[model samples]
Target: MAYKDQKLSEEKVFKDPVHRYVHVRDRVIWDLIAAPEFQRLRRIKQLGTTNLTFHGAEHSRFNHSLGVYEIVRRIISNFENRPHWNNEERLLCLCAALLHDLGHGPFSHSFEKVFKLDHEYFTQQIIIGDTKINNILEKVSPGFSQKVADVIAKTYKDKLVVSLISSQIDADRMDYLQRDAYYTGVSYGHFDMERILRVMRPMEDQVVIKSTGMHAVEDYIMSRYQMYWQVYFHPVTRSAEVILSKILHRAKELYESDDFIFKLKPTHFISFFEGKVKLEEYLKLDESIVHYYFQLWQEEQDDILRDLCERFMNRRLFKYVEFNPNLQMKQWMELYQLFQDAGIHPEYYLVVDSSSDLPYDFYRPGEEEERLPIHLVMPDNSLKELSRHSDIVEAISGKKRTDHKLYFPKDRLDAVEDEQLKHRIIEILYGQGEVKDVR
Candidate 1:
């Protein structure tokens, strides 16, 4: 009840590119951001190895977290006088948005793949465990931390609040879709977020976009579609991920093998390899620490370890070409043998990367794991599923688009003077003509 009247004497502001200025007027919100656990977001890149491709995408999760929080703040501010909007849930929404990504570690997706770590688990830990975030949340009310976690976990009883953060067109998607686009300098992610936010309405158990704003909703869905293919699932990004995964795997293998002696001994990677990493150890890891290991490993005695590290650090990304798995199986095998004959390890050099996404899905009744589909509030007060009314959404709804690429080091192939072997490999990769830039 005290929070109803509580506000910071001097509002805190974070200069943000996406949101312009993220303002915090609540004492609890300001304290939550200052918490060491939340501040750790500064070390984690928002797009991981994406900075390798889009150099401007060097922004951190801290930037995104603040942007998400600002978006939620604006949404709550907009919903203040709307029907079915509870003033009590305002702080909870803001807290959930600010702390949602607190659990993300350095290169979250790649680290999680290698170590099997769950950032969501750590997200709940930071809020509910004995940490600064927990202490701050508890100050608001007993069990407030759990309440905040519930909202993030999407199990909060108030579906409206859940929808605000996790729905098809919520603040989380709204912020990232635009923020990532801005940082990546891509035109596809441009959507009228202001128009979308203005048209948002809180309904029973869900949020809906007014039918008049259907075009805006269509734009948002299309933006998501483009961002997914053009940015999130870019083959080059996946290629980088493949190389990173191999680097981690190689380090783990070396640590297990008696032949390998690391210069730094890979102390940070030990617990991860042994599958007993502590939260504190995990927190110590950032891109810098990982890069430190990679830099040292460049001078490692093991060729595989040194090569992978050098390739990753120097941006010598694996080259890729379109290939079907079933049809190209024989060619892939021959390429592998060719690489072996050429003294290059086929395992590391040859890779196939694929990425896919379902842009939108209409709610299917009786489906156990159905997502609450986006609904357009019609002029006559009836509601329609997004795809039913919007042509673009209809074109992409439940449509899974996929892209596959065969990756290899083209620079290595170009230097090979073995005309017979080089031609065979090049023919397999590029078919007839030279491989052009996929972009």
Candidate 2:
């Protein structure tokens, strides 16, 4: 065994809820897990605001990272006696799996949207920068850190290794879907991962499933689809995300305005507001730090900031209505004016949130960021695209379904001093003024 391949005398194991036990045998993998950059993931939740919707979904990114690494470890272990599988890239796959989400900040989606930050860029920085992760990879060899970063970026020379960690049916998604489902107590993410793994074989340029495993592959696809709509794209989770984004937006606005005085200035967020956030400043944030700022902002003199923070911290999220902007443009405009006339800042109070995704896709040549299509290796040793073999997958292939909801503070509308103004808003929300699912 090489320095990178040195195995521990006794493998270490973590008791995980999703994967049962995540085993670590490689010295390098253990070292990377112990590094501070990897440790930071413990503070970042795997599914940002989904916890507010699913009380049991309190697992952190650290949990999911370990599961992913374990999956890749199992995958490579299975590939050990198989041909066309490079023994050298085994550690690279494990390292990339463990550290892929290293750059995620607190409440990733909203934080990235409001701050205009890219977790992927930060991921590259932490791996390639002069940090603990870089130092560890440097111990492996010169250019090793860059290699792992490239693997994560899906630009590595060996497409087979890249596909193992990033492709549609890779370890990352495999771990998260199962882990999230277990935590959220949802039945949707269950799939025969064992059967899928058994069918997976490394090819020269990619990993492909055997034709016999088509049913398992279809099950995995369905699990992904169910988990997306049931857990990831839950409207209530989006409500919390909306509130979180609004809170950040208000904080950023106040940070930039002269009228606001901060008893506790956002030392960590200043760089973000200035549009020049460095890696160190970005890494200094987590859910707790954000909550700390939120707690204090409730006391700030700025009513909008204070109110939004209190709502977020207290779980008083805005209510939402099914809204299609294209079909209901006039209604949306009318509601906007009503909010403004009612003294509610339409910009802050009225928001449209949309969630959309293409559940599965075949190889799309010449398109931007084209995902490597999932391929099934037939018994004859020829490969066919996933949608071609799986009817369930084909039905939703290349089809992007989107759901949009208009979010507003219902309590604010209800407390309006003007009777008729409130009546009109309520009437529009419930055509016959029948209040349903107001919460």
Instruction: Indicate the worst ten consecutive residues by lDDT in candidate 2.
Output: 357-366
The lDDT, on a scale of 0 to 1, for candidate 2 is 0.85
Model 1 error, position 34 (Å): 0.6
Residue 404 displacement in candidate 1 (angstroms): 0.9
What is candidate 1's lDDT per residue for 1-439, written digit by digit as tens? Answer: 4853479888878888877899989988888888889888898898988878888888889988999999999989999988989988999999999999889988778778777888888888878988888988988889999999999999999999999888888888888888999999998888899998899998888889999998988888888888887888876777788889888888888888887677877888899888887777777788889999999999998888788889899887887788788777877788889988877787777877666321223322112346568888988978888878877877877675765677777877887778899888888887623564533
Q: In model 2, how many backbone clashes occur? A: 0
Candidate 1 lDDT (Cα, 0 to 1): 0.83
What is the per-residue lDDT of model 2 for residues 14-126, given as tens digits with 9 covering 90 to 100? 99887789998889988888998888889988888787889899889999889999899899999997989988788888899998888888888887788888889999999
Q: What is the C-alpha lDDT of each candidate?
A: 0.83, 0.85
